[model samples]
Target: MKSLLTAITTTVLLSACAHHDDVRPGNDNQHYVVIKSVDRSEGIKEALGQATHYCEQSQSNMVVLNETIDYKGELPEHDYLKTRATAEFVTEAGSWLWIIGDGHVDDVAAVAAVAGAGKLHSMGAPYFVTVNFRCT
Candidate 1:
Protein backbone atom coordinates (compact mmCIF):
# COMPACT_ATOMS: atom_id res chain seq x y z
CA MET A 1 0.00 0.00 0.00
CA LYS A 2 2.84 2.38 0.80
CA SER A 3 4.54 1.64 -2.55
CA LEU A 4 1.31 2.21 -4.42
CA LEU A 5 0.89 5.59 -2.80
CA THR A 6 4.44 6.54 -3.67
CA ALA A 7 3.95 5.57 -7.28
CA ILE A 8 0.80 7.63 -7.52
CA THR A 9 2.47 10.65 -6.00
CA THR A 10 5.41 10.41 -8.37
CA THR A 11 3.12 10.14 -11.36
CA VAL A 12 1.19 13.17 -10.30
CA LEU A 13 4.31 15.26 -9.81
CA LEU A 14 5.79 14.34 -13.17
CA SER A 15 2.62 15.13 -15.01
CA ALA A 16 2.40 18.49 -13.35
CA CYS A 17 5.86 19.43 -14.61
CA ALA A 18 5.36 18.17 -18.15
CA HIS A 19 5.03 20.61 -21.04
CA HIS A 20 1.60 21.35 -22.43
CA ASP A 21 0.75 21.19 -26.12
CA ASP A 22 0.48 24.75 -27.43
CA VAL A 23 -0.52 24.03 -31.00
CA ARG A 24 -3.93 25.13 -32.26
CA PRO A 25 -5.52 24.45 -35.60
CA GLY A 26 -6.16 27.44 -37.83
CA ASN A 27 -8.46 27.54 -40.86
CA ASP A 28 -7.88 25.22 -43.84
CA ASN A 29 -5.67 27.88 -45.36
CA GLN A 30 -3.46 27.97 -42.27
CA HIS A 31 0.16 26.79 -42.19
CA TYR A 32 2.83 26.27 -39.52
CA VAL A 33 6.58 26.82 -39.12
CA VAL A 34 8.95 25.91 -36.31
CA ILE A 35 12.44 27.01 -35.19
CA LYS A 36 14.53 26.11 -32.14
CA SER A 37 17.65 27.57 -30.56
CA VAL A 38 19.63 27.57 -27.33
CA ASP A 39 19.36 31.35 -27.05
CA ARG A 40 15.88 32.47 -26.03
CA SER A 41 15.86 36.16 -26.98
CA GLU A 42 17.86 35.68 -30.13
CA GLY A 43 15.63 32.84 -31.27
CA ILE A 44 12.51 35.00 -30.96
CA LYS A 45 14.14 37.90 -32.76
CA GLU A 46 15.19 35.66 -35.61
CA ALA A 47 11.71 34.19 -35.85
CA LEU A 48 10.11 37.63 -36.06
CA GLY A 49 12.48 38.70 -38.79
CA GLN A 50 11.69 35.61 -40.79
CA ALA A 51 7.97 36.29 -40.45
CA THR A 52 8.35 39.85 -41.63
CA HIS A 53 10.29 38.71 -44.66
CA TYR A 54 7.56 36.28 -45.57
CA CYS A 55 4.91 38.97 -45.21
CA GLU A 56 6.89 41.23 -47.48
CA GLN A 57 7.25 38.57 -50.11
CA SER A 58 3.58 37.72 -49.88
CA GLN A 59 2.37 41.31 -49.40
CA SER A 60 0.30 40.23 -46.44
CA ASN A 61 -0.02 41.93 -43.05
CA MET A 62 1.56 40.18 -40.08
CA VAL A 63 -0.76 38.79 -37.46
CA VAL A 64 0.51 36.81 -34.50
CA LEU A 65 -1.80 34.10 -33.28
CA ASN A 66 0.14 32.71 -30.33
CA GLU A 67 3.46 32.63 -28.50
CA THR A 68 4.89 30.32 -25.86
CA ILE A 69 8.04 29.49 -23.92
CA ASP A 70 8.91 26.09 -22.49
CA TYR A 71 11.57 24.47 -20.37
CA LYS A 72 13.94 22.14 -22.25
CA GLY A 73 15.57 20.09 -19.50
CA GLU A 74 14.67 17.48 -16.93
CA LEU A 75 13.09 18.43 -13.66
CA PRO A 76 15.73 19.74 -11.30
CA GLU A 77 16.72 18.06 -8.07
CA HIS A 78 14.86 19.38 -5.06
CA ASP A 79 17.99 21.09 -3.75
CA TYR A 80 18.81 22.65 -7.11
CA LEU A 81 15.33 23.85 -7.90
CA LYS A 82 15.86 27.23 -6.26
CA THR A 83 19.20 27.91 -7.90
CA ARG A 84 18.67 26.35 -11.29
CA ALA A 85 16.56 27.83 -13.99
CA THR A 86 15.67 25.77 -17.05
CA ALA A 87 16.57 27.13 -20.47
CA GLU A 88 13.55 28.60 -22.23
CA PHE A 89 12.51 29.89 -25.69
CA VAL A 90 9.46 30.95 -27.58
CA THR A 91 7.46 29.45 -30.47
CA GLU A 92 5.34 31.83 -32.50
CA ALA A 93 2.45 30.86 -34.76
CA GLY A 94 2.74 29.26 -38.20
CA SER A 95 0.23 29.48 -41.02
CA TRP A 96 -0.16 28.54 -44.70
CA LEU A 97 -1.58 31.80 -45.95
CA TRP A 98 1.80 33.32 -46.67
CA ILE A 99 2.78 30.70 -49.22
CA ILE A 100 -0.61 30.50 -50.84
CA GLY A 101 -0.81 34.27 -50.96
CA ASP A 102 2.62 34.76 -52.45
CA GLY A 103 2.14 32.09 -55.10
CA HIS A 104 5.92 31.74 -55.06
CA VAL A 105 6.47 29.01 -52.51
CA ASP A 106 4.96 25.58 -52.13
CA ASP A 107 6.54 24.99 -48.70
CA VAL A 108 3.89 25.84 -46.16
CA ALA A 109 6.14 25.28 -43.19
CA ALA A 110 8.81 27.54 -44.62
CA VAL A 111 6.44 30.42 -45.10
CA ALA A 112 4.94 30.01 -41.66
CA ALA A 113 8.41 30.08 -40.13
CA VAL A 114 8.87 33.55 -41.51
CA ALA A 115 5.92 34.86 -39.56
CA GLY A 116 6.85 32.83 -36.49
CA ALA A 117 10.29 34.37 -36.49
CA GLY A 118 8.79 37.78 -36.98
CA LYS A 119 6.54 37.28 -33.99
CA LEU A 120 9.52 36.47 -31.77
CA HIS A 121 12.57 38.32 -30.51
CA SER A 122 15.73 37.22 -28.78
CA MET A 123 15.50 36.64 -25.01
CA GLY A 124 19.11 35.50 -24.64
CA ALA A 125 17.87 32.03 -23.74
CA PRO A 126 17.59 28.74 -25.58
CA TYR A 127 14.23 28.26 -27.27
CA PHE A 128 12.08 27.28 -30.23
CA VAL A 129 9.67 29.06 -32.59
CA THR A 130 6.46 28.06 -34.38
CA VAL A 131 4.40 30.27 -36.67
CA ASN A 132 0.79 29.84 -37.85
CA PHE A 133 -1.14 31.89 -40.38
CA ARG A 134 -4.33 31.89 -42.45
CA CYS A 135 -5.97 34.05 -45.11
CA THR A 136 -9.46 35.52 -44.72
Candidate 2:
Protein backbone atom coordinates (compact mmCIF):
# COMPACT_ATOMS: atom_id res chain seq x y z
CA MET A 1 0.00 0.00 0.00
CA LYS A 2 2.84 2.39 0.79
CA SER A 3 4.53 1.63 -2.52
CA LEU A 4 1.33 2.29 -4.38
CA LEU A 5 0.95 5.66 -2.67
CA THR A 6 4.53 6.65 -3.54
CA ALA A 7 4.02 5.81 -7.19
CA ILE A 8 0.84 7.82 -7.29
CA THR A 9 2.52 10.83 -5.70
CA THR A 10 5.42 10.72 -8.16
CA THR A 11 3.04 10.57 -11.09
CA VAL A 12 1.13 13.54 -9.79
CA LEU A 13 4.23 15.72 -9.46
CA LEU A 14 5.46 14.83 -12.95
CA SER A 15 2.14 15.63 -14.58
CA ALA A 16 2.03 19.03 -12.88
CA CYS A 17 4.90 20.24 -15.02
CA ALA A 18 3.64 20.95 -18.55
CA HIS A 19 5.83 21.88 -21.46
CA HIS A 20 5.25 22.95 -25.04
CA ASP A 21 6.99 21.45 -27.99
CA ASP A 22 7.95 23.52 -30.99
CA VAL A 23 5.32 24.22 -33.59
CA ARG A 24 5.54 21.62 -36.30
CA PRO A 25 4.42 22.15 -39.86
CA GLY A 26 2.30 19.49 -41.41
CA ASN A 27 3.93 17.31 -44.03
CA ASP A 28 2.79 17.95 -47.62
CA ASN A 29 0.28 20.49 -46.42
CA GLN A 30 1.35 24.12 -46.47
CA HIS A 31 -1.69 25.29 -44.58
CA TYR A 32 -1.63 22.61 -41.93
CA VAL A 33 0.39 22.74 -38.70
CA VAL A 34 0.74 20.68 -35.56
CA ILE A 35 1.01 22.00 -32.03
CA LYS A 36 2.18 19.52 -29.43
CA SER A 37 1.37 20.02 -25.78
CA VAL A 38 2.57 17.85 -22.97
CA ASP A 39 -0.75 18.71 -21.43
CA ARG A 40 -3.97 18.55 -23.46
CA SER A 41 -5.63 21.92 -22.86
CA GLU A 42 -2.36 23.77 -23.23
CA GLY A 43 -1.59 22.04 -26.52
CA ILE A 44 -5.02 22.79 -27.97
CA LYS A 45 -4.61 26.35 -26.79
CA GLU A 46 -1.30 26.57 -28.62
CA ALA A 47 -2.83 25.22 -31.81
CA LEU A 48 -5.51 27.86 -31.77
CA GLY A 49 -2.99 30.60 -31.08
CA GLN A 50 -0.69 29.40 -33.84
CA ALA A 51 -3.52 29.17 -36.36
CA THR A 52 -4.62 32.63 -35.34
CA HIS A 53 -1.15 34.03 -35.91
CA TYR A 54 -0.93 32.35 -39.29
CA CYS A 55 -4.26 33.78 -40.37
CA GLU A 56 -3.31 37.27 -39.28
CA GLN A 57 -0.02 37.02 -41.12
CA SER A 58 -1.65 36.01 -44.39
CA GLN A 59 -4.83 38.00 -43.86
CA SER A 60 -6.80 34.81 -43.67
CA ASN A 61 -9.07 33.08 -41.16
CA MET A 62 -8.32 30.15 -38.88
CA VAL A 63 -10.29 26.95 -39.09
CA VAL A 64 -9.37 23.97 -36.96
CA LEU A 65 -9.38 20.80 -38.98
CA ASN A 66 -8.92 18.06 -36.42
CA GLU A 67 -7.58 17.33 -32.93
CA THR A 68 -6.15 14.11 -31.54
CA ILE A 69 -5.18 13.34 -27.97
CA ASP A 70 -3.13 10.30 -27.20
CA TYR A 71 -1.31 8.64 -24.36
CA LYS A 72 1.90 6.83 -25.34
CA GLY A 73 2.75 5.59 -21.87
CA GLU A 74 5.93 7.06 -20.49
CA LEU A 75 7.73 9.57 -22.68
CA PRO A 76 11.50 9.76 -22.81
CA GLU A 77 13.17 12.02 -20.28
CA HIS A 78 12.36 15.57 -21.38
CA ASP A 79 13.52 18.70 -19.52
CA TYR A 80 10.42 20.68 -20.37
CA LEU A 81 10.73 23.17 -17.52
CA LYS A 82 11.69 26.67 -18.62
CA THR A 83 15.12 27.70 -17.42
CA ARG A 84 15.08 31.28 -16.29
CA ALA A 85 17.86 33.59 -17.38
CA THR A 86 19.71 36.09 -15.26
CA ALA A 87 19.87 38.37 -18.30
CA GLU A 88 17.09 38.98 -20.81
CA PHE A 89 16.06 40.97 -23.84
CA VAL A 90 12.54 41.43 -25.16
CA THR A 91 11.03 43.28 -28.07
CA GLU A 92 7.60 44.85 -28.27
CA ALA A 93 4.73 42.78 -29.55
CA GLY A 94 2.69 44.21 -32.42
CA SER A 95 3.82 43.26 -35.87
CA TRP A 96 6.31 40.93 -34.24
CA LEU A 97 7.07 39.48 -30.80
CA TRP A 98 10.39 38.50 -29.33
CA ILE A 99 11.34 37.17 -25.90
CA ILE A 100 14.87 36.01 -25.23
CA GLY A 101 16.29 34.06 -22.34
CA ASP A 102 18.36 31.02 -21.58
CA GLY A 103 16.99 27.79 -23.06
CA HIS A 104 14.21 29.81 -24.66
CA VAL A 105 13.05 30.43 -28.22
CA ASP A 106 11.24 33.38 -29.72
CA ASP A 107 7.94 31.57 -29.77
CA VAL A 108 4.70 31.33 -27.83
CA ALA A 109 6.47 29.89 -24.81
CA ALA A 110 8.71 32.90 -24.65
CA VAL A 111 5.70 35.16 -24.46
CA ALA A 112 4.26 33.05 -21.68
CA ALA A 113 7.49 33.10 -19.73
CA VAL A 114 7.75 36.86 -19.90
CA ALA A 115 4.23 38.12 -19.26
CA GLY A 116 3.61 35.56 -16.51
CA ALA A 117 0.24 33.80 -16.30
CA GLY A 118 -0.55 31.17 -18.88
CA LYS A 119 -2.84 28.20 -18.37
CA LEU A 120 -3.28 26.66 -14.93
CA HIS A 121 -2.34 23.02 -15.36
CA SER A 122 -3.21 20.85 -12.41
CA MET A 123 -1.75 17.54 -11.36
CA GLY A 124 -2.66 14.42 -13.35
CA ALA A 125 -3.48 16.25 -16.55
CA PRO A 126 -3.78 14.35 -19.83
CA TYR A 127 -0.59 13.01 -21.34
CA PHE A 128 -0.55 14.78 -24.69
CA VAL A 129 -2.64 16.79 -27.07
CA THR A 130 -1.81 16.98 -30.77
CA VAL A 131 -3.74 19.64 -32.63
CA ASN A 132 -3.83 19.88 -36.40
CA PHE A 133 -5.17 23.10 -37.79
CA ARG A 134 -5.25 25.06 -41.01
CA CYS A 135 -4.91 28.73 -41.75
CA THR A 136 -7.40 29.72 -44.40
Candidate 3:
Protein backbone atom coordinates (compact mmCIF):
# COMPACT_ATOMS: atom_id res chain seq x y z
CA MET A 1 0.00 0.00 0.00
CA LYS A 2 2.78 2.45 0.87
CA SER A 3 4.57 1.76 -2.40
CA LEU A 4 1.39 2.33 -4.36
CA LEU A 5 0.85 5.62 -2.56
CA THR A 6 4.38 6.73 -3.36
CA ALA A 7 3.95 5.91 -7.01
CA ILE A 8 0.75 7.90 -7.20
CA THR A 9 2.32 10.90 -5.52
CA THR A 10 5.25 10.81 -7.87
CA THR A 11 3.01 10.63 -10.88
CA VAL A 12 1.02 13.62 -9.71
CA LEU A 13 4.13 15.71 -9.13
CA LEU A 14 5.57 14.86 -12.54
CA SER A 15 2.31 15.71 -14.24
CA ALA A 16 2.20 19.05 -12.48
CA CYS A 17 5.70 19.88 -13.65
CA ALA A 18 4.81 18.94 -17.19
CA HIS A 19 1.87 21.26 -17.10
CA HIS A 20 4.10 24.09 -15.99
CA ASP A 21 6.50 23.45 -18.85
CA ASP A 22 3.61 23.74 -21.29
CA VAL A 23 2.56 27.16 -20.02
CA ARG A 24 2.96 29.89 -22.63
CA PRO A 25 1.65 33.44 -22.81
CA GLY A 26 0.48 34.08 -26.39
CA ASN A 27 -0.08 32.40 -29.71
CA ASP A 28 1.72 32.46 -33.03
CA ASN A 29 0.94 35.27 -35.56
CA GLN A 30 0.23 37.51 -32.57
CA HIS A 31 2.52 39.65 -30.56
CA TYR A 32 4.00 37.64 -27.68
CA VAL A 33 5.28 39.11 -24.44
CA VAL A 34 6.61 37.66 -21.21
CA ILE A 35 7.25 39.24 -17.83
CA LYS A 36 8.70 37.53 -14.79
CA SER A 37 8.82 39.02 -11.30
CA VAL A 38 9.16 38.08 -7.67
CA ASP A 39 5.40 37.82 -7.42
CA ARG A 40 2.63 37.05 -9.82
CA SER A 41 0.77 40.32 -9.20
CA GLU A 42 3.84 42.45 -9.77
CA GLY A 43 4.73 40.53 -12.90
CA ILE A 44 1.26 41.12 -14.30
CA LYS A 45 1.47 44.79 -13.49
CA GLU A 46 4.70 45.16 -15.39
CA ALA A 47 3.43 43.18 -18.37
CA LEU A 48 0.36 45.36 -18.76
CA GLY A 49 2.45 48.49 -18.54
CA GLN A 50 4.67 47.25 -21.32
CA ALA A 51 1.68 46.31 -23.45
CA THR A 52 0.22 49.79 -23.11
CA HIS A 53 3.54 51.27 -24.13
CA TYR A 54 3.58 49.16 -27.25
CA CYS A 55 0.11 50.27 -28.22
CA GLU A 56 0.89 53.91 -27.63
CA GLN A 57 4.06 53.68 -29.63
CA SER A 58 2.26 52.18 -32.55
CA GLN A 59 0.13 55.25 -33.14
CA SER A 60 -0.49 58.45 -31.24
CA ASN A 61 -4.25 58.18 -31.77
CA MET A 62 -4.63 54.56 -30.83
CA VAL A 63 -7.50 53.79 -28.49
CA VAL A 64 -7.73 50.75 -26.33
CA LEU A 65 -10.95 48.90 -27.05
CA ASN A 66 -10.99 45.91 -24.68
CA GLU A 67 -8.79 44.09 -22.21
CA THR A 68 -8.91 40.63 -20.68
CA ILE A 69 -6.97 38.86 -17.97
CA ASP A 70 -6.31 35.17 -17.45
CA TYR A 71 -4.72 33.41 -14.51
CA LYS A 72 -2.92 30.30 -15.66
CA GLY A 73 -1.98 28.34 -12.55
CA GLU A 74 -1.56 28.23 -8.81
CA LEU A 75 1.55 28.59 -6.65
CA PRO A 76 4.16 31.26 -7.26
CA GLU A 77 7.24 29.64 -5.80
CA HIS A 78 7.30 26.85 -8.32
CA ASP A 79 7.04 29.31 -11.18
CA TYR A 80 3.75 27.83 -12.26
CA LEU A 81 1.51 30.77 -11.53
CA LYS A 82 1.04 33.08 -14.50
CA THR A 83 -1.15 36.04 -15.40
CA ARG A 84 -1.90 36.94 -19.00
CA ALA A 85 -3.46 40.16 -20.28
CA THR A 86 -4.72 40.82 -23.77
CA ALA A 87 -5.63 44.25 -25.07
CA GLU A 88 -7.16 45.34 -28.34
CA PHE A 89 -6.74 48.78 -29.85
CA VAL A 90 -7.63 50.74 -32.93
CA THR A 91 -5.04 52.90 -34.58
CA GLU A 92 -5.53 56.28 -36.20
CA ALA A 93 -5.57 54.58 -39.58
CA GLY A 94 -8.41 52.32 -38.49
CA SER A 95 -6.06 49.37 -38.22
CA TRP A 96 -6.59 46.74 -35.55
CA LEU A 97 -3.90 46.39 -32.90
CA TRP A 98 -3.48 43.36 -30.68
CA ILE A 99 -1.14 43.09 -27.71
CA ILE A 100 -0.56 40.25 -25.29
CA GLY A 101 1.28 40.41 -21.98
CA ASP A 102 2.20 37.36 -20.00
CA GLY A 103 3.47 37.58 -16.44
CA HIS A 104 4.71 34.98 -14.02
CA VAL A 105 6.96 34.44 -11.03
CA ASP A 106 9.59 32.27 -12.61
CA ASP A 107 13.23 31.44 -12.10
CA VAL A 108 15.22 34.60 -12.58
CA ALA A 109 18.17 32.76 -14.06
CA ALA A 110 16.08 30.82 -16.51
CA VAL A 111 14.31 33.97 -17.65
CA ALA A 112 17.60 35.75 -18.18
CA ALA A 113 19.01 32.90 -20.18
CA VAL A 114 16.45 33.43 -22.93
CA ALA A 115 16.89 37.17 -23.09
CA GLY A 116 16.92 38.57 -26.64
CA ALA A 117 16.60 35.13 -28.15
CA GLY A 118 13.78 36.23 -30.45
CA LYS A 119 10.92 38.52 -29.48
CA LEU A 120 12.23 38.90 -25.92
CA HIS A 121 12.65 42.64 -25.42
CA SER A 122 14.01 43.08 -21.89
CA MET A 123 15.12 41.10 -18.88
CA GLY A 124 16.19 42.43 -15.51
CA ALA A 125 16.63 40.04 -12.60
CA PRO A 126 13.17 39.32 -11.25
CA TYR A 127 11.32 41.21 -13.96
CA PHE A 128 11.18 40.61 -17.69
CA VAL A 129 8.81 42.06 -20.29
CA THR A 130 8.15 41.07 -23.90
CA VAL A 131 5.80 42.77 -26.34
CA ASN A 132 4.48 42.16 -29.83
CA PHE A 133 2.30 44.38 -32.00
CA ARG A 134 0.31 43.63 -35.10
CA CYS A 135 -1.52 46.22 -37.18
CA THR A 136 -3.92 45.56 -39.99
Candidate 4:
Protein backbone atom coordinates (compact mmCIF):
# COMPACT_ATOMS: atom_id res chain seq x y z
CA MET A 1 0.00 0.00 0.00
CA LYS A 2 2.79 2.40 0.84
CA SER A 3 4.58 1.58 -2.39
CA LEU A 4 1.44 2.11 -4.41
CA LEU A 5 0.81 5.51 -2.79
CA THR A 6 4.41 6.54 -3.41
CA ALA A 7 4.19 5.56 -7.06
CA ILE A 8 1.01 7.53 -7.59
CA THR A 9 2.42 10.58 -5.83
CA THR A 10 5.63 10.42 -7.89
CA THR A 11 3.67 10.17 -11.12
CA VAL A 12 1.51 13.16 -10.23
CA LEU A 13 4.51 15.27 -9.27
CA LEU A 14 6.35 14.39 -12.50
CA SER A 15 3.29 15.28 -14.57
CA ALA A 16 2.95 18.66 -12.83
CA CYS A 17 6.59 19.59 -13.41
CA ALA A 18 7.20 21.80 -16.42
CA HIS A 19 9.95 21.09 -18.93
CA HIS A 20 13.12 22.99 -17.96
CA ASP A 21 14.94 24.95 -20.63
CA ASP A 22 18.69 24.68 -20.81
CA VAL A 23 20.72 27.76 -19.82
CA ARG A 24 21.86 29.65 -22.88
CA PRO A 25 24.26 32.52 -23.46
CA GLY A 26 22.73 35.89 -24.10
CA ASN A 27 24.35 39.10 -25.36
CA ASP A 28 27.13 40.76 -23.32
CA ASN A 29 28.41 37.59 -21.62
CA GLN A 30 25.16 37.11 -19.75
CA HIS A 31 23.26 33.87 -19.43
CA TYR A 32 19.50 33.37 -19.60
CA VAL A 33 17.37 30.55 -18.23
CA VAL A 34 13.65 29.80 -18.08
CA ILE A 35 12.17 27.32 -15.65
CA LYS A 36 8.60 26.44 -14.78
CA SER A 37 7.46 24.54 -11.71
CA VAL A 38 4.42 23.80 -9.58
CA ASP A 39 5.79 26.32 -7.09
CA ARG A 40 7.24 29.74 -7.83
CA SER A 41 10.24 29.67 -5.52
CA GLU A 42 11.30 26.28 -6.81
CA GLY A 43 11.52 27.58 -10.36
CA ILE A 44 13.68 30.49 -9.24
CA LYS A 45 15.86 28.20 -7.17
CA GLU A 46 16.37 25.85 -10.08
CA ALA A 47 17.40 28.75 -12.28
CA LEU A 48 19.94 29.83 -9.68
CA GLY A 49 21.31 26.29 -9.46
CA GLN A 50 21.79 26.14 -13.22
CA ALA A 51 23.50 29.51 -13.19
CA THR A 52 25.78 28.45 -10.37
CA HIS A 53 26.75 25.30 -12.23
CA TYR A 54 27.49 27.31 -15.36
CA CYS A 55 29.71 29.75 -13.49
CA GLU A 56 31.52 26.90 -11.75
CA GLN A 57 32.34 25.32 -15.09
CA SER A 58 34.17 28.53 -16.04
CA GLN A 59 35.89 29.04 -12.67
CA SER A 60 33.88 32.22 -12.09
CA ASN A 61 31.26 33.49 -9.74
CA MET A 62 27.61 33.97 -10.56
CA VAL A 63 26.03 37.42 -10.61
CA VAL A 64 22.31 37.80 -11.22
CA LEU A 65 21.55 40.33 -13.95
CA ASN A 66 17.75 40.45 -14.12
CA GLU A 67 14.66 38.29 -13.95
CA THR A 68 10.96 38.27 -14.74
CA ILE A 69 8.36 35.95 -13.23
CA ASP A 70 5.27 34.97 -15.18
CA TYR A 71 2.20 32.84 -14.67
CA LYS A 72 1.88 29.87 -17.02
CA GLY A 73 -1.28 28.21 -15.85
CA GLU A 74 -4.85 28.84 -16.90
CA LEU A 75 -7.40 30.12 -14.42
CA PRO A 76 -10.11 27.62 -13.45
CA GLU A 77 -12.16 27.16 -16.68
CA HIS A 78 -14.78 29.91 -16.84
CA ASP A 79 -13.11 32.12 -14.29
CA TYR A 80 -11.56 34.16 -17.08
CA LEU A 81 -14.79 34.41 -18.99
CA LYS A 82 -16.67 35.48 -15.89
CA THR A 83 -14.16 38.21 -15.13
CA ARG A 84 -14.37 39.51 -18.69
CA ALA A 85 -18.12 39.58 -18.64
CA THR A 86 -18.21 41.52 -15.41
CA ALA A 87 -15.69 44.04 -16.66
CA GLU A 88 -17.54 44.47 -19.90
CA PHE A 89 -20.81 45.13 -18.13
CA VAL A 90 -19.26 47.81 -15.99
CA THR A 91 -17.57 49.45 -18.97
CA GLU A 92 -20.79 49.45 -20.97
CA ALA A 93 -23.16 50.34 -18.17
CA GLY A 94 -20.87 52.97 -16.61
CA SER A 95 -21.32 54.45 -13.10
CA TRP A 96 -24.96 55.29 -13.67
CA LEU A 97 -25.80 51.76 -12.62
CA TRP A 98 -24.29 52.39 -9.21
CA ILE A 99 -25.11 56.13 -8.83
CA ILE A 100 -28.85 56.07 -9.66
CA GLY A 101 -30.14 52.47 -9.32
CA ASP A 102 -29.39 49.77 -6.73
CA GLY A 103 -30.16 46.67 -8.81
CA HIS A 104 -27.24 47.16 -11.16
CA VAL A 105 -25.18 47.94 -8.11
CA ASP A 106 -25.87 44.39 -6.91
CA ASP A 107 -24.83 43.06 -10.30
CA VAL A 108 -21.64 45.09 -10.12
CA ALA A 109 -21.04 43.85 -6.61
CA ALA A 110 -21.42 40.27 -7.79
CA VAL A 111 -19.08 41.04 -10.66
CA ALA A 112 -16.50 42.42 -8.31
CA ALA A 113 -16.75 39.39 -6.09
CA VAL A 114 -16.39 36.96 -8.96
CA ALA A 115 -13.46 38.87 -10.48
CA GLY A 116 -11.62 38.97 -7.17
CA ALA A 117 -12.24 35.30 -6.63
CA GLY A 118 -10.56 34.43 -9.91
CA LYS A 119 -7.53 36.50 -9.01
CA LEU A 120 -7.26 34.83 -5.64
CA HIS A 121 -7.63 31.36 -7.11
CA SER A 122 -5.02 32.11 -9.78
CA MET A 123 -2.48 32.85 -7.09
CA GLY A 124 -1.89 29.09 -6.86
CA ALA A 125 -1.28 28.55 -10.57
CA PRO A 126 2.05 27.31 -11.94
CA TYR A 127 4.96 29.75 -11.99
CA PHE A 128 7.42 30.54 -14.75
CA VAL A 129 10.52 32.49 -13.87
CA THR A 130 13.31 33.72 -16.10
CA VAL A 131 16.66 34.52 -14.62
CA ASN A 132 19.58 36.37 -16.16
CA PHE A 133 23.04 36.00 -14.74
CA ARG A 134 26.59 36.88 -15.58
CA CYS A 135 29.70 34.83 -14.80
CA THR A 136 32.22 37.15 -13.24
- What are the Cα lDDT values of the candidates? 0.48, 0.50, 0.39, 0.70
Error of 3 at 84 (Å): 23
TM-score of 1: 0.38
Candidate 3 positional error at 66, Å:
12
User: TM-score, each model?
Assistant: 0.38, 0.38, 0.28, 0.48
Residue 127 of model 4 has an lDDT of 69
Clashing pairs in 2: none
Candidate 3 vs candidate 4, lDDT winner: 4
Sliding window of 10 residues with minimal summed lDDT for model 4: 90-99
User: Model 3, 44: alpha-carbon shift in Å?
Assistant: 0.3
Which candidate number would show the highest lDDT if scored against the true structure?
A: 4
lDDT of 4 at 2: 100
- Kindly report which residue stretches of model 4 are placed more than 4 angstroms away from their true locations once superposed: 1-21, 76-125
Off by over 4 Å in 3: 1-29, 60-136
The local lDDT score (0 to 100) that residue 132 gets in candidate 4 is 90
Residue 112 in model 4: lDDT: 57
Badly placed stretches (over 4 Å) of model 1 are 1-27, 74-126, 134-136
